[model samples]
Target: MHDTSLYSSILGLSSQWHIANAVLDSKARSLRLDIAARSCAEFCCPVCGGAAVRVGADKGCWQHEDLLNMRFHISAVIPVTLCKTCGTNRISVPWERAGSCFRCMDNP
Candidate 1:
């Protein structure tokens, strides 16, 4: 079993989300963390305060700080929601900005 807490802390992730899996390749010297949402029912529209429905996911990876001297990538199937008022919108992530390739969890 892998240490979820370690990755969680490394990524500064909330308990609401957890690392679904992590792939480590010695030859490639890379670590990829697959993140999954704990619950979609609690998600709300960014523009409106109304409940949203999951339409699909946007699969992408964000470059992360080096871990154990290996290049790290934090990947996720970020939920795309259909808001009653906004039509369709991407869910805001906690680790990165609304639209960015870099993780801004520790950044001000």
Candidate 2:
């Protein structure tokens, strides 16, 4: 997990999410972090709060505050969950609000 935990903590992530991989493009001046859910983790339906199983994932990218004067991008495999009662739903990422593609930044 080498330095990944550091990035996770910087990103304000919890146990459910972790940094799977990362790339720093100094030439392009950007940092991209790939995020994934814990494999053995169980998810609940956002609508019904019932137990849900991961069916698949959707690739998504969102811009975060710049890091070291370079663009910071958070890329994640957003989980698609199957709930018996609610059918299918896309689980929300901790960094972003539902249906948005931008990470929420702290106000100071």
Candidate 3:
């Protein structure tokens, strides 16, 4: 397994998620990971907690604490799901909180 695979586990991502790429900018002192959901993955309605189908996706970037003195960032393709009851909503990533641009390491 490559080091990027280790990031998936470290980030608490499930099998449904995949790390598409990883970039390290030594000069910039930043580490970025690009993540996406598996094609067969399904999401729940953020509002109603019901099954939803992916309608679209948007690019999102989030900042995380520095790793080994390098700035860490997470760039993802965020899926937008269409729920019968709630219309369309952006699915939350496992490492982030709803409506937040930062990662949550512990329950708050």
Best by TM-score: 3
Off by over 4 Å in 1: 25-29, 39-41, 65-69, 98-108
Residues 1-108, model 3: lDDT tens digits: 247766776677888789888888889998888899888888888789998999999777777666567777888887899999899998877777454446533333
lDDT of 3: 0.79
TM accuracy, model 2: 0.76
lDDT of 2 by residue, 1-108 (tens): 247776777666879887988888889998888898888777899789999999988777778566557788887877899999999998877767555435533222
State every prediction's TM-score relative to the real structure: 0.70, 0.76, 0.79
Give the poorly placed runs of model 2, Cα more than 4 Å off: 65-68, 98-108
Instruction: Evaluate model 1: give its lDDT.
Output: 0.73
Kindly state the number of residue pairs that clash in model 2: 0
Ranking by lDDT: 3, 2, 1
Worst 10 residues of 2 by lDDT: 99-108
Better of 1 and 2 by TM-score: 2
Error of 3 at 10 (Å): 2.3
Q: Which structure among the candidates has the greatest lDDT?
A: 3
Candidate 1 residue lDDT tens string, 1-108:
467787787667776577889878889898878898776445678678688888877776677556678878877877788997899987877767544445533333
lDDT scores in order: 0.73, 0.78, 0.79
